[model samples]
Target chain A: MASSNTEPVIIVEGLTARYGEVTILQDVSFEVYRGERFMILGGSGCGKSTLLKHMIGLIKPHAGRVVIDGVDITRADEETLHRVRSRIGVLFQADALFGSMSLAENVSLPLAEYTDLPPELIREIVRMKLGLVNLAGYDNHMPSELSGGMRKRAGLARAMALDPTFLFYDEPWAGLDPVTAAELDILIRSLNEGIGTTMVFVTQELASIFSLGQRVIMLHKDVKGIIARGTPQELRETSSDPRVNHFFNRQAD
Target chain B: MPEMNHRGYRLHVEGAPGAQAAVRLEGRLALEDLKALMADLQAVPVKMKPREIAVDVAGVEYLDSAGAMALIEMENLSRSLGIPFELLGVSEKDHGLLCLIDREALQRPPLRPESERPAIVVRLGEVARRQYRDVLEIMTFVGELVAALAYCLVHPRSIRWEEVKFYMKRAGADGLPIVALISLLLGLIMAFMSSLQLKQFGANLYVANLVTIAMVRELGPIMTAILVAGRSGSAFAAEIGTMVVNDEVNALVTMGFDPIRFLAVPKVLAAMVVVPILTVYADFFAILGGLIVGITGLDLTAFTYIQQTKSSIRVFDFATSLVKAVVFAMLISGIGCQRGFQVRGGAEGVGMSTTSAVVSAIFLIIVADSAFAIMLHYVRH
Candidate 1:
């Protein structure tokens, strides 16, 4: 991993997002520094997913800017935006694997499309990526045949195909059992440590946030912006806000 | 800082006695440049190899997973030749991503070649078995639909009257203008063609008889059925397929409601009611088309043409066609609903089911029409 630098890889300034008449997020500003595991935490219906989408340039915010690697993605031209996007990878909540394709084919898609490599080499890379997720030799299986946790793992393998410097995960362990969820957490932490890739993860799982997140921001539906920001241990021990306390303590508020 | 470029990837090799060989890499190291990198590395002789190889990556502007794998593969090759390999000057970002690559998996032998093709007989047998199973499944679906209909008849209040009305408007009322226009054009074409043959025999007066019989007995019912199959059959399949994919059908089952009754019944009933009505309109327009030819080509009056058509057609002819229309409607909507319920996977599944619904409905309609024609022919004789 790169040494912890003062320079941030991503800068979101006064971002306000809306869908038609309904406002989703307002004035959401944050800087994601290089080599940090940044976690976005919130309850259901909060704008965590919306904020992630804005960061990846999937959805444009109604106001303000998101600067990624020195380029303002909000105002970048299609070509420039595409160049920026090539450096980042996202795993959606649904896994969103192409259902018709086998696991190997799914993982090989980005490499095949973007590079002029021999088919033999691409096939080898696909195997290595799948192996990273502990899915070796399951390449020929269709996405529909995999269990939910396995499917999510396959999705992660596909996301890592390009070896993106920045990775964003949306609820990586949402539907998995406790054991599988913990296994996924361990995999994520190892990947962060071993590869030193910058990660921005959106999750409501308190256990995962506490264990894996280096820095955390809690979004609230009522405020439509971040209400708490700190290291997970700091928030748990020193935060004065009742909601933050309630969250860390697992109280029904 | 000596500049070196080879196949879009710059490589500078430095070797000294009793020292590790330093290979400086620059430019973008990605999948596109893998072939050149592999060839260049292979060109180095194994006899002169040192104990360790230092790969300097500081000048490399960009590196992806493929590039990482290339380095790993090179490392494995060096180890095989009794040499240790190490990467030097890797940026923090590149190092992080490169570490995620599982070196053990990368060193595995290339994937086995695809399996051999199956024998022709085996392939044919498999297809036949699949089609047979599909037929059995459709038969079971029809039986379930009939049971649901029987239940609805016994309990009149169970029918979803609102959905029936909605489908009737969509499949019947909304379909009216297009159906009428197409039927009218068909009638005009039939009258115009037959009039030419009749006129050659100086028998233009018989045009009314030919047009009336042809439209009522065959064209009117068959054309109406085909139009409805294309319009509403595909819609039923697509709608139900989407519901199946969305798990709405499963939800209905869990809620103690029969999916066939709640979804398919209304569509079937609406088509059954509306298709016959459209056939009658088609028959009327056909007779009018024949009358136009009679007035213009045969120098006959409107009164004369009407009298000829009325004398030539019987009530049995109209009743037979209407009966055919009703049966066609049932087949179209039933097959559509069945195909929808068969959908699996995702959006592509829905699309496939929709296309199959129209094709199967049309095929069944034509087959049923042939059976009706053969039975009617024997009875008439």
Candidate 2:
């Protein structure tokens, strides 16, 4: 057991999120420890993305709170939220890169906006971040000029531009070939192991969840909350819930 | 141990006679206290000038990326000044952060020099090349539209009558109120201004001739076409541009349907048919405005004003305006559809295409009107 003195970096308590009259997620609770790769797993329409958004403070929860480093993000003011947001980075599902900017400009945006660094130093940092993602010399290429996998890597580079403490990825391997997906998985693991930055990934891909996650929380649309939580080995070997077993074993209902 | 406290942060330096100097930092080291922390760190090398510096961050309660960057900068400065530097006693959280900084720093590539902007002649050549490509694309679009029209003529049943009616109502009936309002006001202003000049010489009766001939020959078609270009042309570009962005045009192509036939033809045919009818309305409204001016401002009876207007406008003048209306409609719809098909990227692309459609349509309308004016002058001679 971890020591009680070491506080969890993120504590999401009884979070209930809704869009209009439709409740997407309810009573969802989880904790992400420092230096851990946490995975949110569910099938389509299970509100994984919504949960991620609530955690990021992009969407206000219908109820409950997300406390990051002992500060409740749901109730945090703009100043507090800005500080919290600057410490974390989110990679959207669509990559959501600024369509008008080249890869270098996209990667440089957070640094430029947050710091008072000179342009020369900012450019050097941009090249370094892009290099980390294996896109070293493609600075002049626009987002439209990049392939799907390259754009995702660029988005990842942009996310890490400020050396954020917590990184959130929404479907990092959603639309990539097997080779590129494995490459990204390797990159994610290396980044986590090398830097120890806390990572939270939302994905339904069994391979990715097994490969990258240190701990996993499974959500269900029918339950409208987390249905199961455990490590991949534990879930695979000891879980008795039919849905959990079926999901882990890849058995169709 | 000697410690310096500033802005809620502390830095303690410990040095031995033959051992490396050690610096301990504590408290919140975030953006707010970054400048003070940097200033304090800068004084270390100047004051003690240690041959080797080791920073201990075990007591740091909070450290953001900005703090890490400042620390890295200090490390780099110490190294550059021939002082070896190292970080010691970093906690798990701080170690993670410092590791990120160290990794990024090690991987930091040399910055490339900014490329100079190309020479003016090179820029001009690029623009000319783009314009030439645009002209070719436009010509190809015109040819495809003509072929689609020919196909429709051959097989009348294949024509999308429903789409034609939809676009007709959207382009013509939906735009009627604004077009009528602007045309009425334009005619009123023209007649009022011309009457001010004609009344000076007892030639106020000629105001009726001036308004009628001008409205029928040039102003009516041009004004109606400009209004339609602003309204319907922009709409066409935006609607089809969005469709193109969403890959609906590609879907149509994959389904063995020409987008020109399915999309562009209905808009062009509708514009060609409705603009001429709108031009006739504009001409009538302008003549009525002249009649009003002649009666109220010139002390002439309404019948005399109507008779003067009727005699001034010939069949040739009316036909020429209708012909101009057709040409203007073709330009408006053609350019609008062409711009729509050229849409790339996303929502911004749609907006650019819409604006380009309106501007290009108006420009082509004026150019075509001038060409018609030159031809008419020679024909009259």
Candidate 3:
């Protein structure tokens, strides 16, 4: 639906990553369309997180370019990269909140840095962001004082502080229980619909893939590239690749 | 289209004076000029004190969360001023953002204010209790270390020689240059200063006696101990403290490894073995330094100086210096491991432990040296 008229929001062209003599990912290419939910699923050590990092320009590829919002972040100048980065947000797996700052301070940091808004407006925006994540009235809690699920939600609030057009999540459900993770999944879905923001999720959670993924790419360790690319339903119902089938059906092998 | 600034904001008021007024806002209502926007909204109710104010935002191009919140704040201000107010031309996207903010949540008070600082007497008492607990913890750690060392003594094959070797290279070999440099300079300064007085008495040869006696007994061992404390002692604390912070130490314990024996013993053994050897090297470099001063500054032959140094130092002096070196090594390594084990919290805790390791090691080294000096004086007499 987002083809032709509007350009793709992200373009990862001919990406290759190597660690010493070992090739982790080779000649991987993909495009994320505007306002679509894209999922990257792979087995452990299959380079899911590595690919996500490359897509976000956190780790430079041995050979490739990642263009976000038409700016090639891989080769962009600092000012251009910063401008490109301002339109996107990333939620790391470890919930990298500043241990020294309170939850409100963590959420307000981007607003204070990037905007010329008054302190009162920034404060209200922080409240709205936190409230969006169901973390209302917890502005004074330190990151150390919060539970794991709470910290993850707080991290999400901080990521959404600038209302970025693109959101990238790295294993958002890795450490949560089923109920909490399901709640988080629902929250992500609501935010996606409400904000109409493009999202790229790197996860192995089949439930999340089925529930939220509009498009999916499966990375394979042996092949060192994407093995299957399609919608989650198509991959689950029609894919002939044994690896893709094994992953979707939760097979042991 | 109305005129707008570079930030894309404009405010227009219509209706004659003292008549019902309509306020029109146009262009991008975004975070960039929110401060000025807020000032404009505040001026709306004051300037006209209008009986009714209608805010129209249909011409607004963009509305961020801050922009939405600013409009809400304006509505609240108008309500408090008892002026009838209404918002017009709310776009679908803007209305969604406005609905997302929970107004009651914003009005809720913070959970609690920051706690006030305690009284001086209470803070002093807390510090005293903390120091007391620190002493008790040190004693317990010393006991555990002794037990682990005794176990290793009984089963020498059980000692981790690999770790011992690794630490030896770090604490001993890597520390040689600084130890050599500082002791050499110390010996040169001592000899030169003592030579001035000795030259007055025309006893330049005795400068060798003074330098040899001082270097072998006090300066050589103490200077080497201080350097080792600064180099390896802080390193030991920081390394182990970071492990504690990362839960690596806890993992080792959960896997049935005695953290003291597994982590501390090798570093302690390495320091004890290398520090005494380093002190001997320190003594040699210091004497060489005294020989340089004697030849260049004191007009004494190397052979004469060497002969005086040899006669001045007995086997008793070497034994005493080695004893001091070994004891200082134990203190440095022991306090370092103890402080590291006591670490809590995060990276700040590791930093605090590292600094405490160096300062405490130097202090204890000087204290022990004083005790040795007094005890050795009576024994020599």
Candidate 4:
């Protein structure tokens, strides 16, 4: 396995995204080293989704660059971007599961669209992915029927369907109960060990980020960007930045 | 008290020719006094146009946030009443002070000159919105449905048929009573209203032809389609709107399933399946209404009215209406569900989407009925 020191799997350099005159993200530079479970932490409207969109090539950077797997995604062709995306799994915030589709259909959608596998083989793979997420028996369930955690787990199952080397989880633990959140944390760790995939997470929930992020990157709302990045423990004791201190001091707010 | 009126300021509110209201005030004429003066001006006959409040604030000094907020309120109220509001006869120092405090209000874009102003973009939001007439939209919807059905066949279990049945019950079954009632009411209404107009000519028997022709050929299908659209169309929007607000739509998208295909497909299918049945229910009630009108108003027998209806109603007429109802149903359900899925906000979004769905469905149903009528006219000719 290539260590993070050898080369970074994802790099966002001085990236900015603007909606009309309002700049949501400004000049952010960060790297997700190979095999690292990277986390981006901020409150709502802090442009975390905007950052994710830029990193995943869904959006073009306004004034900078995003390089994923040695490709300059800011100016890359659609085919090139698709190839890069095919190698990564994205578990979006809200899980983004289709309400019209059953659990089995939702999990198997990616393979149906992108793979040449036969229907029987596809079904088997879908079953395996659901089994991994502990949603195997609920294949016929609609998204409306699933509990919030089960829906997220189902989304995770779909993400794992592609067997990608890099995974991005956007607020995987959000809106989940504490027990379900803990279960997601366990799933994240197990998935990391089992697939050895590089991971990046965006979340405001501090406990999961501290427990799951191999390295955490703190994004602040004002002009300064990427204010702090470090191991969770290192951030807890030695961080001197007031924003970092306030964030780590861990008030209920 | 009379001496206090004499010391009060002489204010000239300029530009509003018809709306000059005088204020009676007392003392130093501070900005607060001016504000009170403006408040009193509201009682004036400034209903038609620009209101002019000329305050002589020369006697007083200083304006703060409260003064500014009051002036802003005045500006807003005057604008709302279609009256121009201007301050005049004020000392230069006080004018500058007032302007400084109400800078935002002062700098708003003034009404444009007739030649330079951009023409108002006129949108009906209601007028001329028939799904059938908009061939491009119809084709796009059909294309989307085809894609969804194809996807379903490849992933049969992806759609929970039971959930679809749940929605179907709401959209189709629940809609029947309302659709039936409206169709019945419509038939009676058309028969009575047209008879009242035609009765002046002593042609009460023609009410039979009129009701039969109008109900079976036009009003029955059209009204039934609209009623269903309002009821079921709104329901579809609410269902999809709630799903969207709750993030179920996003979850589907993340899971590699297109929400349009998943949520929209089954709804379109259900509508395509149910609209014809609803139309049949509507037709039966409408004919019944016509029969009642014929018996009571004209002193005619129910037997004669039925005989006339049976003889006059063509198989083509019935089929055409059914065909129109199916098309209208598609129009109502498709537009409603599509608009619902487009909702963006949370709870308010669900409400907005539901309202839009009903409005669009009704509008589209009317437009579709007319277009179908025109088509039938041309084909028959």
Using Cα atoms, each model's DockQ against the true complex is: 0.40, 0.24, 0.46, 0.01
Per-residue alpha-carbon lDDT of candidate 3 for residues B165-210, written as tens digits (9 for 90 to 100)? 9999999999999888888887899889999898999999998888
Worst 10 residues of 1 chain B by lDDT: B107-116
TM-score list, all predictions: 0.89, 0.84, 0.91, 0.46
**Tens-digit per-residue lDDT, B106-126, candidate 4:** 333212221243444423432
The lDDT of each candidate is 0.86, 0.85, 0.87, 0.71
Ten residues in sequence with the least summed lDDT for candidate 4 chain A = A1-10
Candidate 2 chain B: worst-modelled 10 consecutive residues by lDDT: B105-114
- The residue-by-residue lDDT of candidate 1 on B1-381, one tens digit each, is 233655667888777534677788888787667777776664442544665788899998877666777787888888788777788898887887677777877655434434468999999999999899899989999999999889988987999999999998998998888887887777777778988888899888888888899999999999889989999999999999999999999999999999999999999988999999988988888788778778887898999889989999888888989999999999999999999999999888999999999999999999999999999899778
Q: Candidate 1, residue A247: CA error in Å?
A: 3.7
* lDDT, model 1, position B51: 58
Runs of candidate 2 with Cα error greater than 4 angstroms are A1-36, A54-84, A190-198, A223-226, A229-246, A251-253, B1-9, B12-21, B28-50, B61-82, B91-113, B202-206, B239-248, B284-309, B344-351
Cα shift from native, residue A126, model 4 (Å): 1.2
| lDDT of model 2 at position B47 | 66
TM (chain A) per model = 0.96, 0.96, 0.96, 0.94
lDDT of 4 by residue, A175-229 (tens): 9999999998987776675445689888878788777877888887785368787
TM-score of chain A of 1: 0.96
Q: What is the i-RMS of every prediction?
A: 3.8, 4.7, 2.4, 31.6
How should the candidates be ordered by lDDT, best one leading? 3, 1, 2, 4
lDDT tens readout by residue for model 2, A204-245: 888888778888999999999998988877888998888888
- Give the C-alpha lDDT of model 2: 0.85
Better by DockQ, candidate 4 or 3: 3
DockQ of 4: 0.01
Flag regions of model 3 displaced more than 4 Å.
A1-6, A116-124, B1-3, B13-23, B46-48, B51-53, B83-85, B192-201
Q: Is candidate 2 or candidate 4 better by DockQ?
A: 2
